[model samples]
Target chain A: MYGWIWRRLPGNAWVRAVISLVLILAVVYVLFQYVFPWAEPLLPFGDVTVDGASAGAGAGREEGAAR
Target chain B: MPVRLVIRTFSELCITVGAVIVLFVVYVLYWTGVKAADASDGEIHRLQDQWSRGRIELPAPGATASAAPPDATQEPQKSQAPQATRGAPTAPTTRSAPAASAGTEPARRPARSTAPAARPPAYRDGKPFAVMYVPRFGRAWDWPVLEGTGVNTLKKGLGHYPGTAALGGRGNFAVAGHRRTYGDPFKDVPLLRPGDAVVLTDGASWFTYRVDRRAYRTVPTDIGVIDPVPEKSGFRVPGRYLTLTTCEPEWGSSHRLIVWARLEATRPVTDGKPPALRS
Candidate 1:
């Protein structure tokens, strides 16, 4: 997937390297601000309510509870 | 030459996948903390600004007389207010508590004779209502205490369990926070011992609660840990209490670490910072 994007870049190796860094940062920003949050609820860990309603308790996922 | 091209592309693909996985881990462990720190700090500053402007919202005066749980007494009075006004990012929406007991008003109405204050404060779902300080954590450990324990609510800071007592009120005032991430507000819950003070302020008064026991471990299913008189918390009578819960195993959520506390004292902000915080 990334190889295709790299091959299509209209620049020399040095210029492409800088563009690649910027592209990587943008992807990271999107993943952190939107994609991961939307995906977190679908996972079964990070629940702290002690209400017994949370599913999939054995995954051993770390972090705080959200449910 | 064709074989060489295929090998180069395959190697690049493998490296890209590996990088993505590593980035996800960083998101979970590091980036979340940074975001939570920013959110919680903003909440704290906003609360302080309100307090400075004399916009502190104390509990309703009628709440002072009747010592029943908040769900039974407070919900009925505000039942007319639409509980469905949720999802607005900034509005202070009413709580969406389980209204099964909205009826059956307590007969002790005469005890609650105090007139409603100029403006009765409604519990704003998913919004911050107080700031909590744990001296055991550090001289600077503080987090905003928001209402509701929903996934999004706890992301900002500690979440107050709905249906529990108001801060410094008569029943159990329970709050939950993440143990490992989202600023890890309760990261040192296990370190709390008897006599440690968990001080909280609602911009009006300082409430200091004294830890009553070492950290108690229980399953997430055990809801009794936050009861008016929590099981195994060593209290036999109904009284002002505080329950702080976080996930167990330091990293996983299979169980919970509980720290039970009792209200030690309360003082208005006019008196200055509580003694617990001076140290």
Candidate 2:
């Protein structure tokens, strides 16, 4: 998959490397700013309240309560 | 050539998945803390600015009117006053910030009634109304206490349970914070010792609560720990109390750790920092 992506690039190797770096950073930026925050509430690691169901089983119940 | 391509793609997919997982862990453990710190600091500054401008955000007066008993509803009721001063003249003199001590003192002292004061007006959810400091956490460790315990609220800093007692009021003023990420506001919750002070200010008065005991371990479902008279906390009657809850195991939320405190003293902000904070 990565080889195919590399071969389809429009630039020489150096330019492709720079473009890849920028693309990688943009992906990470999106992950941290949007994806992770949205997904964190779905995970059990951040749970703190006493009213919700325990982590792992029925995790969605806790997420709903938290909302 | 097709088989080679398939193998290469499979290897790249595996490597990409592994890298993403590691990055997610870094986001949870480190980046979140950085973002929370910035958010919490901004909240503290905003609260202080509001206080300096003489704007104290109280819960809507009528919202809790029916719930609060007649005696408890009074704004300056003795029930909500700080119980007593527990310090000697020779204060610890540990680390006092000059910037913090510059405010003018309130002209009148808090009344000494012993009744448990009613809960204060309901603060708006996600709005910061007070600042909390634990000397044990470090002289510089302080966080803005926002008014709800929801996930997004806790990310800003310590969150005050909505139905609990207000700061310096009778009943339990329970707070929850993250033990790992989101600035790890309660990371040292387990280290709190009996008599350690958990000080808080709502712009007008400084409330000093002394740790009643070391951390009490319990499951997250044990909501009784924040009761006005938490059974396991050694409190036999209703009184002013504080409960700090955080996830246990340091890095996971499998269980919970609780630290109970009793109101020790209430000082007007103009009087300077509270005694517990001096050390």
TM-score, per-candidate, Cα-based: 0.76, 0.81
lDDT of 1 by residue, B1-279 (tens): 889889988998899779877877788788888988999999988887665544445552232322222343224334323222211111111222244223322111111213332231477877888999999999889999988778878778888777777777766888888887678788888889899999988854567899999999998877788777887899998777899988887777689989999888664443346678887
Candidate 2 lDDT over residue span B61-141, tens digit each: 112212223332122233222212211111111122232233333222332345336555668878998899999999889
Q: How far is B113's C-alpha from truth in model 1 (Å)? A: 15
Specify the CAPRI tier of model 2: acceptable
Grade the docking of candidate 1.
acceptable
Candidate no. 1 TM-score: 0.76
Clashing pairs in 1: A46-A65, A47-A65, A48-A65, A50-B220
Once superposed on the true structure, which residue ranges of model 2 sit more than 4 Å away at CA? A54-67, B59-111, B114-116
